[model samples]
Target: MLVTEKSPIVIVGCADDNYSMPLATTMSSVIANVSSQRQVVICIIADKITQANKNKILKSLKKPNVIIEWLIPDYAKLTNAIISRHITIASYYRILIPELLPEKYQKAIYLDSDVIVKANIEKLWDTEIADNYVLAVRDMDIDATYVSSSKGLQNYQQLGIAPDCKYFNGGVLVINVEKWRRDNLSQEIINYISNNQQYIRWHDQDAMNAVIAGKWSELDPRWNSQAVIHSYSSWKETSLTEEMYNNVINDSYIVHFSSSAKPWKLGCKHPNRMLFFQYIDLTAWAGWRITFIRKLWLKVKDMMKKKGISFSQA
Candidate 1:
C-alpha cells in the first residue's frame, strides 16, 4: 500500500533558453516512480516566457499525482530583487526551497532539475529528524572546510553551528518546515545575503552552509550520488562495476546528474544518463523515434572520435 501521510515531495527547478523539454521529461519520470498516493508539487520559474513555452511546459507536467506551479520571477520582480540582494546562483535553489513548498506539508524533499527518480521517495519521507533539524546529502566532491573557509567561522558561530560542522550539498534536502517557520530562516537567509553580499562565493549554498551546518542531519549518499566527470571516468576505468551500477539504478531513491554533462547534451557519457533514457517512456512512437535517432547519432560520433584518435602517434 502506498503511504499517503508525509508522502508529498516538493521540488524546484528553473527554465532557461536552452533546455526545458528534457527537464520536463525527467520530472515526469520522477512522478511515475513515486507511489500513486504521493503528491509532487513542482515550481517552475522562468523570465520573459512566451505562450508557446508555457504550453510546452504544461504538456510535460500533465502527469498523474503532480501539481505544477508556474512562477514568473520577473512578474514579481524577484529577479531584480535577487540581484539587488546580491544572491549567488547556488543561493537561488536554497531561497526557493522554502518559498516554493506547499504550505500544508510540514516537510518536503528538494531536488534539482538535473535528476531522475529510480526508487520510491516514501523511503526518504519516512526518515525522522529527531533533533529538530533538517537533513542534507553530503557533498562527496569538495573538502569539508571549503564552505567554512569561504565564510569566516564567526558568521556561522552566531547561528549555533559548530566551527567544524559537516558541510553539506544543498542539491537534495529534506527540510523541516516547522523549524524553518519557527526560526524564520528563510527571511533571515535573504537578509544575510542582502547584508553581506560581497562576502559570498557560492550564493545560497555558502549561506546555507554558514547557517545550517551542524543543524542538518546527513542523509545516505545513495539518495543523491550525482554523476560528475571524475566519477564517470573512474567508473569507466574500474570502480563502477556492473553490479554497482545496477544497484544504483534499482535501489537509489534519486539519481542526480548534477554536472555539466546533461543527458540532453551531445557528449553525455555518464552511465546514469543511459538509465535516464530508459525510464523516459515516450507516449508517442514519434517521440521514441526521435530519441532513438539521437542515440544512434551519439554512438556514431563516439565511434568516429575513438577511431580518429592518435594515442599511439602522440
Candidate 2:
C-alpha cells in the first residue's frame, strides 16, 4: 500500500465472481511471503466481479507496501469467442496485459487464480527474463509422452511451432511486456484467439504455446510447482527423474493447482487441497467448508460414472 519511489513488483491475476476468493487466496499467500522491502502492486483482470467480492478480497489481503488495482476490460467479442464453460472469458484477459496495462511497466508476473506463493516472490520477480518473449516453467503435467504421442507434435508442426520445443504451463509467466508491445504480440495473440479455434485445444494456453514456440525461456520448476495429486505416475510423465521431481516439489516457491478439481470444491481428494485452505482461512471467508451433502453427492456421482450406471437409467 505504500506507493513510494521504489520500483513495485507487479503481479496480475484474472478472475470472475466465482474465482475471486481463490484469487484472494493467491494474493494473500504472495503478500504474506514477500519481504517488506519489496514494494508490490497487485492487478486483477476483473470480469463482471461483484462489489461485495472485491470488498472481501480487500478485507482479506489488506497490507502495506502492496496496492491492488482492478481492470475491467470490455471484451466486445465475448459472444464470438469459442470458450468452454469452464474457461471463462477472463482467462483470455492475461494475453492482453501488454496493451491493457500502463506503458510504464516493462514486465510483470501473471498468476492463475488457483495458485499460492510458498517462498519469497522476489526469487521469481527479480529473475532475469533472458531476452525471451516470456519466462515459464515446463509444465509438470504435460509430459514428453503426451506431447510426442498425441496430436501435439503434429499440431505444433502444423502451426509452425518447432518440434523440439517445450510446452509450458501458462499458470505462471514472467512476461516481457515491453517486448510484447515492440513485437505487437498482444494483437497477434488476439488474432490467434479470434481466428484459430481449430488449432487451439487448451484455449489461450494452446494459443500461447503455438504463437511463441521456442521463443520463450525456461525457469526452475520450483517457480511454478504444479499438479494437485503428484505421484510416481506424474514423474513417469515428465522428463524429470524421481529424485529430481521430489526436489522440485519439496523446494517449490509457487504451488499451482492447475487442474479443474480445485481445493474449495467437495471431494477434491488432492493432498495439496488443504494448502489452499490455509490461506483461505486467513481471508474474510473463514470457517467456510464443503458441505457433507455436497461431498456425499459427489461421491455418489463418481461411483455411478465409474460403474457406467447413470441415475436416470438406474
Candidate 3:
C-alpha cells in the first residue's frame, strides 16, 4: 500500500555550504517526485551556509507544494561527543529531530546530503514503523550483528547489546519523533557516545545503533541502495546478495552515494552516479560539467598507473 498522509510530508536534512548545491539537487528530485497534491515541509539544519547559497536553494526549489524552514542549532554541547574525521556536526543534527521539529510533526524522514530521491517521499513518510523506533536500510558491507567480543561486538557488548544485535546504516531514517522524545533518546545517545568514546568508531552512527539496536525496522534494500564495493563488483558478503544488487541497479527508489567515491568526484564506480548528475542538471548548477581536461587527465593518469608507470617516469 502507498502510504498517504493528511499532514504535510516532513523531510529533514542537514548540510553546510559545501553541499548546498547537492542538497538543492536532492530537494529538487524530492519535490519533483512527490505527489503534487501532498503538502511538503522541508526542515534543514544549516551549518554556516551563505545567504547567496540559501537563495539559490529557494530559487532552485520552485515547487509550490513545498514549504521551507531553516534551523540553526548550537552544536557546542556535542564538542565532547564522539565525531569522526571528515564528518561535520551537521550530520549529527538528525538525532535531535524530535526536539527540533514542532509537536505536530510526530515523525520525520531524515535524508543525507549525499543522496537523491527517485520515488515519492510519501511512500517513505507513510511507512508504518509499527513497534520499532526507526525505519532504515541495512548496510551492504557492514553486518547487522555485533557478532562476538573479539570480532565486531566491542562497542555492542560495552553497551550491553546482544552479540547478534542489528546495526543499521544511519544515512536514511524514518524517525519516530514522539518515541524519541518520549524515551529521551537524544540524551541517552549522547550519554552513550560520551561514555564510550573509544568504542565509537562510526561516532553518531554507532551511538544510534547502540542506543536503538534491535528496535528499528529494516526497509527494503532498494529504498536506500548504498553503492559499496560489494554492491558494484560482487565481492562476497552475506548481507549483500546478488538479488539485492539486482534490485539496487534496476529498481531502487533512492540511490545513496554513501562512500568516499562521491558521484561529484572522479573515479567513482557507483552504477547510479549519473543519476545524481541528472538531478544536478535541474539545479542552478545546470550545465556544470567536470572539466574536460581534468577528466582526460585523470583517465590518462589511470591508464599510466595501470601500466605501472611512476609519476616522474610518466
> TM-score, each model?
0.70, 0.87, 0.86
What shift in Å separates residue 195 of candidate 3 from its native position after superposition?
1.0
On TM-score, the candidate that comes out on top is 2
Give the per-residue lDDT of model 2 (tens digit) for 145-215. Answer: 23343534337656755566787788999998889889998777778777776666677777787778788
RMSD of each: 8.6, 5.4, 6.2
How does model 1 fare in lDDT? Answer: 0.60
User: Which lDDT tens digits does candidate 1 get at residues 1-314?
Assistant: 23346555665666543335555666676667777777778777654445665676677677678888865442231232343222223226445555555566566666666778776776777877655457886665533333444433335655566556766666677778767876888777666667666555555666677666667887776777766423543334422455654554456667787765666656667776766666545311114323667777656755665676211100
lDDT of residue 224 for candidate 3: 86
Assess each prediction's global lDDT (C-alpha) against the native.
Answer: 0.60, 0.76, 0.76
User: Which residue pairs does candidate 2 place in steric collision?
Assistant: 1-64, 1-65, 1-66
In the range 18-44, model 3's lDDT, one tens digit per residue, is 678778888888988989999999898
User: For model 3, where is the 10-residue window of minimal lDDT?
Assistant: 144-153
Candidate 1 residue-wise lDDT at 196: 60
Structure candidate 3, residue pairs in collision: none
How many clashing residue pairs, candidate 2?
Answer: 3
Off by over 4 Å in 3: 1-4, 142-153, 229-236, 240-242, 292-314
Candidate 2 has what TM-score? 0.87
TM-score ranking, high to low? 2, 3, 1
